[model samples]
Target chain A: MHDQPSLAELLQAVKHFIDETASPNLSGHPAFHARVASNVLATALRDLEVRTANESAEAASLKTLLAVSDGRSLDDMNRELCKRIQSGDLTATSHGLIAHLKATTIAQVKTDQPRYSGLKTAES
Target chain B: MQDFEAAAHRLFSKVFGAEADLSDINRLSGGASQETWALSGGHFEAILRRAPGGVRPTRPSAAIGLATEAALIRIAGKESLPVAKILHVLTPKDELGEGFVMSRVHGETIARPILRDETFAAARLKLPGECGAALAGIHKIATNTLPDLPSSNGSDQIAQYEDIYRGFDIPHPVFELALTWLKANQPAPIDPVLVHGDFRLGNLIVDEQGLAAILDWELAHLGDPREDLAWICVNSWRFGVTENRVGGFGQLEPMLQAYADAGGAVFSTQEIDWWEMLGTLKWGVMCMIMYEAFRSGADPSVERAAIGRRVSETEIDLINLLEAANA
Candidate 1:
C-alpha cells in the first residue's frame, strides 16, 4: 500500500548492489567484508520474511508446553521455560518438553539457516 | 598511528642481531585477539604474534600470559612435538610491547580447504591419529617446570560461564538448559594437565603430509585432557563434513587408539561424549560473548554478528546430544 518497492525488495536491491557492483571494485579485507555485509543483508531479509509466522508458531508451541493461554510475549514465555528447566521443575525427560524444545529449535534453524544439514536430520 | 614497518625492522634487528632484507610483511587472516604477521628477513622467515597497539597482552580468562606462552612453546618444542619454535619473546628493550616471534612453519590453517581440498587428501586420513599422539605429548608436560597457571575445575568453569551468560542479559532457554545439564553432570575431578583448549582444525597447521604445527596456544589452560580431545571433535569444527567425527578427518578409534598407544590415558567413550557436549555449550557461550562484543561496539565485525546467529546451531546440537543420552 505504501510503495512498490517493499522492505524486502529494497534490501534485496541493496544486497545486489553490494555483491555485484561494490564487491568487484574492492580487494583484500574490504572485499571480504563486502561479502559478509551482503550475507548479513540476506539474513535480515530472511528474518523479515519469516519473523511473524516464526514467532506465532513458537508462541503456540510454548502455550501447549507450558499449558498457558495468557497473552505473554514469546520472549517472556521462553524465559519462563528456561527458569522451569533450570529450577528442575521441568527436565529433559519432562512430558512434552523435549518435543517442544526440538520442534521450536528446528523451527528456528529453518528461519535462520534453512540450508543447514542438521535440519533434515533433526526433523526425523 | 604506529609505524609498523619501522617497528618490524627494529624487531628484526634485535632478534636476528643484524639488519636483513625483510619483505612480504602481510597479516594473516583469522583470530581476533592477537595480531599475526608473516615477515621474512634475509634467510629467516617467522610469524610474529603481538599485542595490537603495543600495549599489555590481553587474553581470555584461562590463558597464561604471553611470556608463559613463549615458555610453553619452547617446552613443547623440546618434547619433539610439532610446534612452532619460539625465536624471541618481547623484552622492554625491544619497544614493540608484549608478544613473541616464532619461526614460521608452513601449512594450511583454514578449515574448509583442509577438509575438502584434494591437496590435503592424504593428510586428512592420518591427521586424527597424529592429533591424538600430539595430545599425548601435551598431557605429559610437567606442571612443576611451567609458570604458575590457573588450574580450572569443573564447578568454577560452569560458574564462570553462568556469570558471562547472565552478563549478556539475553535469555536463551536452550543455553540455560545446557547449563543445567552441565552442572548436573559435572565430571569427577581428574589430575589436571595442560589443555590446548582450542585444539580444533583452525588451530592446527595442516600440510599434505599431516599436521605441520600446532598453533594458537592463547586458550591453553590447565584442565582435563579429555577437554582437548573432545573440543577437536565438536561439530562446528568439522566444517560441514559431520560424518568424519575426529575434526572431520576420520573416526574416533584411530585417534583414541593412537592416544593410548602413545602412553596417554585411555578414557571411555562415555567420558568423551560428556566432554563433547560440554564443548558444544562452551562454544555456544563464546559465540554469545562475541555478540555482546558486537552489541557494545567493542567489535563491529559482521562475522561476530553472524556468529551470534550460530548459537541456535549449538542449541539444536545440544538438544540432540541430551535427547540421545536420555534415551
Candidate 2:
C-alpha cells in the first residue's frame, strides 16, 4: 500500500548516507558516534525484515513449551513463562526449556547481532 | 582552554605549594558515573577522575567515594598493585569539586588494540599472568588499613542483583534462571577479601610490555576473591577472542596458576566457572539497567541503547553456560 522506496529501502539509504557521507567527513568522537548511529539504523532495518517471523516463531514455540491451551498475547505469555521460571514451576532441567531458550535467543541474536559468534556457532 | 588552564593553575597552587604550568590537557573517555581529564604541569603529570559538573552524585553500589578511591589507590600502590600513584585528593579549597589527581601512567585501555595489534603481541602473552599477579597484590591490601567498605558475600551480591533486576521490571527469563541457579548452587563462602569488582581489560592500561596500571576502582568491594578472578573472564570482557577467556589475552590456567604462585587464594576452576556465570548474568542485568536508563530518557544516548541490545548477547552466553552445565 505504501510507496516504491519501501521502509527497508529508506532505512538502507539513510544508513548508507551516514556510513558513506557523514562518517567519512567526521573524525574522533563524532565519527565514532556516527558509526554507532548507522549501526542502530541497520539493526532497525534487520528488525523490520525479521520481526514478524521471529515473533510468530517465538509465540508458537512458547505455546508449546508452556502447553498453553488458550490464546495469549506474546508479551503476556513471555511474562508468564518468566514468572514460571522464577517460581521454580519450570527450571533449567525442565524438558524443552533449553531448546526453547536457545531458539528464542538465537532469533534475537539474528536481528540484534546477526554476526555474533555465538549465533554462528549455534547455527553450525 | 584558558579558563581550564587558569583553574588548573589555581588548583595546583592550592593543592601543592607552587604554580603549575599545565599542558596537554585532554578529556579522556570516562564512564557515565565520572569524567577523566589528563594534564601535565611542568614536572607534574596527572589524571583527574571527577564527577560531572563538579558535584559528586550519589555513589552507586560498591563504589567508594572518590576521596576514598584516592586512598585506596594509595593503599594499592603501597602494596605494589599496579595502580597509578595518587598525588592529591581534592579539597573544597581546590575549587575543582569532588575528585583527586593521580600521576598519569600511560598505556592503552581499549581492548581491541591490546588483543590484536602486533605492537602488543608480547603484552598479550604476559597479560594473563600479570593480571593474575596484580589481582593477588590487590587482595593483599591489609583489611585494617582499608577505608570503610560495605562487606558482601555471595548471597548479599545476589540480593543486590535481584533488587536491580526487579527495579528494571523487564522480563528476562534467562536472568531469572541464572538467579535461581546461583541461589541453588551457592558456592561455600570463603573468607571475604578485597574484590576488584570490574577487573577487566577495558579498565587496564596495557602496553607492549604488559599491564601498566589497574584503573577504574569505582566498583571495588569486599567480597569473595574468586568474584574478582571470575569477573575478568566474563565473555563480555573477552571482546572477540572468546577462546582466551582471561580478558581475551590468555587461558584460565595460567592466570589461576599465577594467582596461586603470587600467594593469592587458590580456587578450583569449577568455582571460577560458577562465578563466571554470575558475572555474565550480572553484566546482562547491568545492560538491562542501561536500557531502562535509555528508555526513561535519563541518559538518552545511542551508546546506552546499543548496550541494551547486548543483553541478548548475554542471553545467548547464559544459554551456552546453562546448556554446558546441563550436558
- Highest lDDT model number: 2
Clash list (residue pairs), candidate 2:
none
Residue pairs in candidate 1 whose N, alpha carbon or C atoms collide under 3 angstroms? none
- Residue-level lDDT of model 2, residues B245-322, one tens digit each, is 888889999999999899998888989988988999888888887777788787787877887888998888888888
Off by over 4 Å in 2: A1-5, B1-5, B12-19, B41-44, B58-60
State the lDDT at B278 in candidate 2: 91
Quote the B-chain TM-score, candidate 1: 0.95
TM-score of each: 0.95, 0.94
Candidate 2 DockQ score? 0.63
The deviation in Å at residue A14 for candidate 2 is: 3.5
Listed for each candidate, the true contacts retained, as a fraction, are 0.56, 0.58
What is the DockQ for all candidates, taken in turn? 0.63, 0.63
lDDT of each: 0.83, 0.83
Q: Quickly count the clashes in candidate 2.
A: 0
Q: Give one digit per residue, the lDDT tens place, for model 2 in A46-98.
A: 89989999989989999999899657988888898889998899999999987
